[model samples]
Target: MNFTHPSIRAQIVSILTAWGMPKHLTDITAEIMVETDLMGVDSHGISMLMAYEEMLKLGQLRIAGEPRVVRDFAATALVDGADGLGHPAAAMGMRVAIEKARQFGIGAVGVVNSHHFGAAGYYARMASSAGLIGLVTSSTRGILMVPTRAAEPVLGTNPIAFAAPAGPGHKPVVLDMATTTVAGNKVKVYHLNDKTLPEGWVQDEGGRPVTDSRVAMDYVFKKKEGGITPVGGPEHLGGHKGYGLALMAHILGGTMVGASFSPIRNRTQKPDDPNNIGHFMMAIDPRAYRDMEEYTTDLDAVIDVLHGAAPADPAKPVLLPGEPEEMMREKRLAHGIPMPQSLIDHVRAIAGRAGVAYELKET
Candidate 1:
């Protein structure tokens, strides 16, 4: 079913409020979720409602908590999220970074003890919108992936994002991606759709390839046996590159924030046990290099050339990292966001329990 952004945001806010979230935090959470849907990242959008509801029920998230600054330097700061929703904490961090970047040539912020912060690109885009280059990375809970030549799970599906301004009438060059072949959320989406996974995406507990999404999710989430693989599948295929990147993110994010690493932290069972998931963000002023306008113009020219590059496959032309997502965002914004039938039903159930009215737009 399709739902207007405002409607979806309102529904989410109402549901969260009913679930005992503070009014202000509920608004922030709803806004972030709705924005994810608006950006066509359905996996991180309203589909996460059930997960948030479960977290709230378990008291893993405190509705009224605010983030606190633990340490500060001229161009850097560390924030303790205080177990608050990741969106608000991240937003505040980016804002602080932007302010510092304006004064200095660059600014960096590290955050810890926050919940899942929707899409990393959103935070990067925030920096780009402020006329600065933005970079972000985060370490997630123990939904580890199968390492090369390894049978069991080890590392989390860490993600990295970068965003920079382009030119007039052009979207920023925003790249956000998981280090793994496929994110756990994508596997969760497939499971929700009653579909199987591809062979390359996961492995069994014994290190054998598996195509069953249920088994994959079960192994990673329940048994802690197997996990999703890195981008290159195995070590022979340069999977070590992805592993290296994941480790880099873990160090910059987790270690810097004083959080436990994936192998040591157990967040699946104890969601509120201060898993200390960490995030890092940096913003750089474009004027530091050259004239801002000329820099963006050159960036646009390069992107245009790449977009027009000769295609290896006629059916699948070259694409910029953010182009596909930008197209999806535009299309969804015009037609309203689509939700799975089961998700719609779940939302309705929540609304019913909360005494809030529910509406689904016609297809």
Candidate 2:
């Protein structure tokens, strides 16, 4: 079923507010999540509410919590999420970083005690929209990644994102990706669609590839056994690079912010304990290096050249990092966003539990 973005956003806001989430926070969360859906990232959009609902019921996500700035410097700062939803905290972090960058040419902000924030690119785009460069990273709650040459999983997907202003006549250059071969939530997307997993996205206890989506989802989310691989398939395919990148994200988002590492936290905390996830947001002002006009003009030239390049398939044009998402947003805005019946049903169940009216009408 296809639903309009406004309908999805309204349902999200209603359910979140009904669940006792602050209206302000729900507004921010709804905007980010619906934008994610518009950008065609099905795994991070409304689909994530299922996990959030479970977290809330288990006492892991606090609806009344608010973000507080804990530490501050001229160009750097830290925020405590107060064991709350990550959206508000992350949005604040990016906004703070953007302000600091405007003043100091660069800014770095970190958030601790946060729960799952949706697409990292949303925060990055906040900076880019302000005519600055942005970078974002976050430590994930689930231990879903099997590091290179590891027998069992040790790391989470640990996503990273970067965005830079593309100036006029071009979209921002944005790149958002999980360090793992595929994000763990993508398994849920496949399960919802009743689709099989592509090889190398997951592996079995014996380290062999698993393509059965149901089995893969069970291992990654439920059983928590042999799981997803690093960005590259394995050691032979340069997966070690991805493993190292995940740690880099962990270092900045988790270790730097003093957030709990899920592997270690699982051993020490109860199942319902707060995930204590962390986020890293940074922004750089191009004006610090050169005039905005010069920077943007050069960037536009580079993008133009890239777009002008010959395509391997003539039917498909050469596209930049964020063009596909922009295209998707345009398409979804014109038509309605597609929602699987299963996802719609699940969300309706959550709304029922929250005592909110189900308002996701088919478009």
Candidate 3:
């Protein structure tokens, strides 16, 4: 099913509102979800509704609370998500950080007691759009990543995102990635699309790679023995570096914010207990260091140099970090976003349960 972006956003808003989410939060979340799809992050877009619906029904995701500041300092702060959806709180945290950066040259904010936020890049872009450098990271509730030489999984995907503006007439540099080799949601994407899991993506109890999509899903989400590898496939291949990066992200995003570590929390908490996820958002003003024209001109020249570099493959040119997403956004806007019929039916089922009208029209 191909749907216009606006239609997708409307359907998301309708279902969220039906589920009793406040209009303002629903609007913010819906826009983020739609933009994630437009940016070609299929794993994090509408597909996430399935997980959210389960959380909603289980009473783990609250629909009534808004984000509130818990602590504030000169250039750093802590935000409470009020045990609600992560989108609004994450958005608020970035906004606050941006404002602080304008005053102090650098700002950092942490969000706690939040549920799964959509693509981190969306929040990073928010800072970039305001002409500041943005850095983002989050701790996950699922224990899907296995550390190097570990027999079982202990870490979540633990994504890290960074974005920086290139002044005018140039796209910002945006890098959003999971410390693990692939995000756990990408496995769900593969399962939904009936695609095979590539080698090195998932491993079994003995650390042998699991290439079968269904088995990989079971290992990552259900059985939970050996799971997704760190960024570098194996210990000999620098997987330890990926493991280190995951810890760094968790330290800043989770521990720093006083959020529960999933592995420890799950041992005592019930199935319906809130995940207590945490997020880190930071912004830095380049103007504090140099003139805007000098910074942007140099950055643009660097980008031009890379763009002019010789490609190893003739068909694939050298592209910047955020170029692919920008290109995808343009393409999706022009052509329409495509989704599997199964996903459409799944969303419709959710709408039925939520008592919302299924009005996602095809483009």
State each model's C-alpha RMSD to the native: 2.2, 1.0, 1.1
Span of 10 residues, lowest total lDDT, candidate 1:
266-275
What TM-score does model 2 achieve against the real structure?
A: 0.98
Question: Which has the better TM-score: candidate 1, or candidate 2?
Answer: 2
Q: Against the unseen true structure, what C-alpha lDDT does each candidate score?
A: 0.80, 0.92, 0.91
Per residue, candidate 3 scores C-alpha lDDT tens digits across 1-363 of: 688999899889999998888999999999999999999999999999999998887888887679999999989999999889999999999999999999999999999999899899999999999999999999998898888878889999999999989967789999999989999989988888788998999999998999888788899886757789999775756688778888998999999998889889988987678899999999999999998789889998998899999999999999999889999999999989999877888989998998888888787
| Candidate 3 TM-score over all chains jointly | 0.98
Candidate 2: regions farther than 4 A off: none
- How would you encode candidate 2's per-residue C-alpha lDDT over 206-283 as one tens digit per residue? 898888888888788848478889998767565888898899999999999899898889888876789999999999
| Per-candidate total of colliding backbone pairs | 0, 0, 0
Candidate No. with top lDDT: 2
Work out the TM-score per prediction.
0.93, 0.98, 0.98
TM-score of 1: 0.93
Screening candidate 3 with a backbone cut-off below 3 angstroms (N, C-alpha, C), the clashing residue pairs are none
lDDT score of residue 191 within candidate 3:
85
Pick out the ten consecutive residues of candidate 3 with the lowest summed lDDT.
Answer: 233-242
